[model samples]
Target: MTAMSPTPHDPLGAVLPPSPDNELDTLRELVSSTYLNHDPSLVTIRAGALFARLKALNRAANHATRAHKQATADSRQEMDHTYLGLQNLLYEKRHLEREIDKCRQFASVYQDIPVHALEDFMQIAPEEAPLNSPNAKGAPQLDLKRKELIKEKEALLKESKAQLATVENVKTHIDNLMKTATDVRRKVNDLVQPLPTTSEPGQSTPAS
Candidate 1:
């Protein structure tokens, strides 16, 4: 009967001198068992899941940004409509002022006429002359159309004001989403950066 030599092994990943053949076999079994104990594809699957989630989040952020841009475009269109209102209002106001001037000018002419002349003008009946004269029939309709235009300008101004408010609200929401997305991306970067890269066991870079 022969006594066998005691086998020695390094436990702390220490460099070793020549090891006995039995010890090498034991070390190989230890490595194989450890590898078998954990799932081989778990790391890759988890990394893929993380990337997919980030991609989805980025797409949502892009959509949000587009929606915000659309809101801006809507606001600009509304501003143009407001300018149209203002321009039309100014034009009508000027036209009304001119019409008032014409009315006053005609009234002054009547004032210059003697009272008997005014009485003489009143006695002339249009029906006996021609009531539906080309110029006479259209004045009231023209005045009504101008009044309607003024009212439309006012309504458009009010609508523009409401659109302005909606634009502001959309801008605020977009700002908040951008900030939140930035934070989320930063967190994802931190999580991904610490993952180990494939390399030889002793080939680690020194801590920076």
Candidate 2:
């Protein structure tokens, strides 16, 4: 007899030691001897007993295989969910940073009203305002300039208020996102925790 050669992909050819082709032949012969050909009742009884035991073992193996597949699928789904959560957090973080930059730029542009300058304008007479001013014959022009400055100051103050409101809104949104992320992390941790195993009602621990 010649030994089979191993394939390149499987150097051992077989993962485990080979089994005897007639391993169960001895057991079959024992059963046949115990239930002789003349006794049909005994043969039926032995055959039924053997079939029931094999059927139970097969059922258990099938159930275990199904459970293993389900567990693998559940783990994959959890990983996908966690990845999606991280993506959302990254998007929110970037958005928050961009909003912070806008807030900083707006803050730099904001200024307090020029109250002292307005007071100086108020002290000047309506007609002789420019007569005593450096730009002599430009009293009307000076008055117009004062009015323009007052309007511009009011506009600047309005814009500053709007910017503050926007900053507050951005801050609120960022806080909400942070809270959501924390909640998701807590939920994932809780879900990932293993449940305690309990013994079956009729089972007992093995003695050491």
Candidate 3:
């Protein structure tokens, strides 16, 4: 008994792959199978399904691209804003530093005087124009007046010192005079007191 050949649907024969017994018959079968599946509606339906899937994917990709672009733009805007703020801060810092340097320069210009004299100097030289202008002819007169006042003060101080010395000398002389008067008074009291004369024991007779 001969063994039967494998059927077309046999799993083992399909795995092994059939040898070509008839090339013409195989070609005819391929054409018939292709014709059977060539339904226009079926092809259209599959093509439509594939197109829909691609459209959905493209839409998702477009949404993602737009979101990414928006996020990038927002980040760039934030960075620009931050950079602008930094620039403003830098400008302000430089301005403040310049102001501080000016203040330091002003302070240095006035550093020669004692701290206590600044208020008096400010009172004296309140404006630069008055100090620099030579047209203020009264300045010379005022300066002369100031010099005379200084001379008067010096003369008064010298006179007061001399007067103080004279007063001290007078006080010393008065103290010495008082001491001399006390000594003279003591000497007068001693001279006025009578010396006692002693009489002998037997003379009792004469009354004066």
Compare the candidates by lDDT and give the number of the best one.
Answer: 2
Taking every candidate in turn, the Cα RMSD to the unseen true structure, in Å, is 21.4, 14.5, 59.4
Q: How many clashes (backbone N, Cα, C below 3 Å) per candidate?
A: 0, 0, 0
The regions of model 1 sitting more than 4 angstroms off are 1-40, 107-110, 116-208
Runs in model 2 deviating more than 4 A are 1-44, 107-208
Say what the RMSD of model 1 is. 21.4
Model 3: how far is 53 from its true place, Å?
0.3
User: In candidate 2, how many Å is residue 82 off?
Assistant: 3.1
TM-score of each: 0.35, 0.38, 0.34
Predicted candidate 1 versus true structure: per-residue lDDT over 1-208, tens digit per residue: 1112332211111211122234334435544655566565864464455445544444544444454345445544554554555555455545545554554444323335333232343367545755457744664675566566658756655665555555455456545545554554443333233212222222445799
Worst 10 residues of 3 by lDDT: 9-18
Q: What is the lDDT of residue 162 in candidate 1?
A: 59
**For model 1, the run of ten residues with the poorest summed lDDT:** 9-18
Error of 2 at 145 (Å): 13
How well is each residue in 117-165 modelled by candidate 2, as lDDT tens digits? 4445557648645545565546566567667767886776676666566
Prediction 1 global C-alpha lDDT: 0.45
Residue 30 alpha-carbon offset, candidate 1, angstroms: 25
Q: Global lDDT of each model?
A: 0.45, 0.50, 0.46
